[model samples]
Target: MPEGPETHALADRLATLLVDERLTHVRFIDPGLQRRRALLERQRVLAVEARGKALLTAVAGGWTLYAHSHLFGFWRFVDDQDALPDGAPPRLVLATVRGVAALYAAPSISLWRTDELGAQPYLAKLGPDVLDPAVDARALLAHMRTPRFARRTLAVLLLDQGFAAGMGNYLRSEVLFQAKLSPHRALEDLATNERRRLANALLDVPRRAYRAKHDDALPPGKDYLARTRAQFGFEVFERKGDPCPRGDGRIVEDRLAGRRLYWCPGCQQ
Candidate 1:
């Protein structure tokens, strides 16, 4: 699944290609969205933005096209040299004089009035977007102290979109590892300094990922003492049974929050 960083990068690329361009044609391969195709055609793209794992295309009218890639969806662009493929599923193709931007295999795509964007159920519940440059770590800390979140394990809270949108399985594991905190630790159990570290890591890790994806560099690893750049990426994610890069212990995996959680027993204490 493409996480927030990848989705953000996709939005940036799509904006570069489609912003300010009028949609010459709009094609919805998904049956659900087909009815709205006529309404989107010839609408100028005002901007393209990413929220969590979803993409939003603001059009000339008051409508914003929302598409969530979910687990297996993607967007592809094609020009004169590169041709659009045939038989892609649930694709919403937006074409202009320059080229075509086709969203393929996406699970959800629909139209929302711009005025109602704030009222959208999913958007309404999300916490501060970690990708937002102005995100307040103090505010996030306050939100976590609420009754609904105060007693949850870091494993669960880290993956909560309502706690911090844009966090996925890999990021949750890596952030905990970076903070040298165990996933089993509950938010209420953490000390002020520990909570500060966790909050900072939550914001820092994903923004690093956004930069790495956009700048074409490797995501920073959890092993802070790593000697070189090559050694400084993804300390615990997908490295189960492998020796910890931090040399504290072997990396291990467990299930948490309905997803795989990876950590090093020796280092993440």
Candidate 2:
């Protein structure tokens, strides 16, 4: 699954390809969406944004396209309609004067009225998107104090979208390690300073990952995401059994909240 940073990067790329550009053509594999194709055709994209793990593309004529590429869904871009990939059929396609963008295998693709977008089930449940520039540490700390979140273990709470939107597996381990707090620690048991540390890490780590993907210095190779992941360089994630970067302990791996987590128990005690 693409995490928050990856989702944001995708939104940015989609913005570059679609924003402010009128859709010369539009198609949807789903029949309901296909019937409403007139809502998108010839409509200019107002914006492309990432809300947690979802992508929202607002189009002209009071409609917003919502898509989430859970695990298998991916996107392909082509400069010409003739060059569009031929394999698996796309769930949605948007073409403009500049190029064509197709979303493949994504299950959650729908159109919502711009005015009623807030009532959309998924968007309504999301917490503050950490990657959102406006979400500061103080805001996160305040959200942390919510009654429900304060009692949950950090291991589970960090994965809660309602706790901190845009948080996922790699970030779960990275944030806990960066804060030097055990994942098993309950938020209610955290000291003031410790809570502040966790708040900082929650905001910092994902933004760092988002920044890593935007680096222009790296050459655009065949596998750009793999290259950026190397650049992001987690301190503890996926380094199980290897010596911790802090040198106090070896990284350990475990499954918590049904997701694999990597952390340095030595430094993260």
Candidate 3:
């Protein structure tokens, strides 16, 4: 599945090409979405925003188009002068005077009245968006401290959208590694300092991944590593059997929360 950062990147690209452009054509390959065609036709795109792993496109017509590229789904965009790829037709297509955007293999596409967007079931249940600059670190910590959350393992907790929206497999592993906390450990097992470190990493890791992906630069204060051209990139994710960055045990992988988690047990413990 494309996580929050990937979805954000896609939204950013689509915004640059689609915003302010009038929708000349709209097609929904899904029969259920055919009714929404009229809502966007001749309407101008006002903005494109990302919420967790979903993309929301606001239209001047007072409605928003929401697309969630669930597991195995993706998007493709072609400029006005360029030819769209020849292949299986995408599940959804939105055409503007400036460009064409198609969503392939995506499973969820809906149109909602702009004023009623907050009532959408998926958006309404999401926790604080980690990428939001105004996210309160303390509030995040408090949310995890509640009785319903305090006993869950960090691996499972991080994957919970109700705990922190935007975290996926890679983000969870990397963040826990940075926090030097074991994925098997529950919140109740953490010391005060460990909880503080984890609270900060939960916010920092995904934001860093977003910046590294979209901006080609490290997050502020992150330094470059000699091994990879990417700055402060993954220290343990997918580095199985390789030497740990901390210079102790080889990186290892194990199943946690139904996802493969990579970490250096030598340092993480």
- How well is each residue in 1-269 modelled by candidate 1, as lDDT tens digits? 87777787788888877789988878787677788776678888998888877788999878898888888887778883248765644377788888888877746877899888888778888888777666767977887778888788999988888988898889999999989899999888899888888888887777777776534443223233122223226878999999987887999999998999999989876
Clashes of each: 0, 0, 0
lDDT of 2 by residue, 152-232 (tens): 899999898888899999999999998999999999999999999999889778877887877754322213233324346
Report the C-alpha displacement of residue 165, candidate 2, in angstroms.
0.9
lDDT of 3 by residue, 1-269 (tens): 87777777777788877888888889898887877698899999999988999899999979999888889778888874247677777888888877888888746888899999998888998988887666767977787777878889898998998888888999998999889988989898899899889988887788767776744644332233112223447789999999988898898999988899998888886
User: Can you list the residue pairs that collide in candidate 1?
Assistant: none
What are the Cα lDDT values of the candidates? 0.79, 0.87, 0.82
CA shift at 177, candidate 1, in angstroms? 0.6
Ranking according to lDDT, highest score first: 2, 3, 1
Top candidate (lDDT): 2
How many collisions between residues are there in candidate 3? 0
Q: What's model 1's overall lDDT?
A: 0.79
Candidate 2 lowest-lDDT run of ten? 219-228
Those runs of model 2 whose alpha carbons end farther than 4 Å from true positions after fitting are: 216-231
User: TM-scores of all models?
Assistant: 0.88, 0.93, 0.90
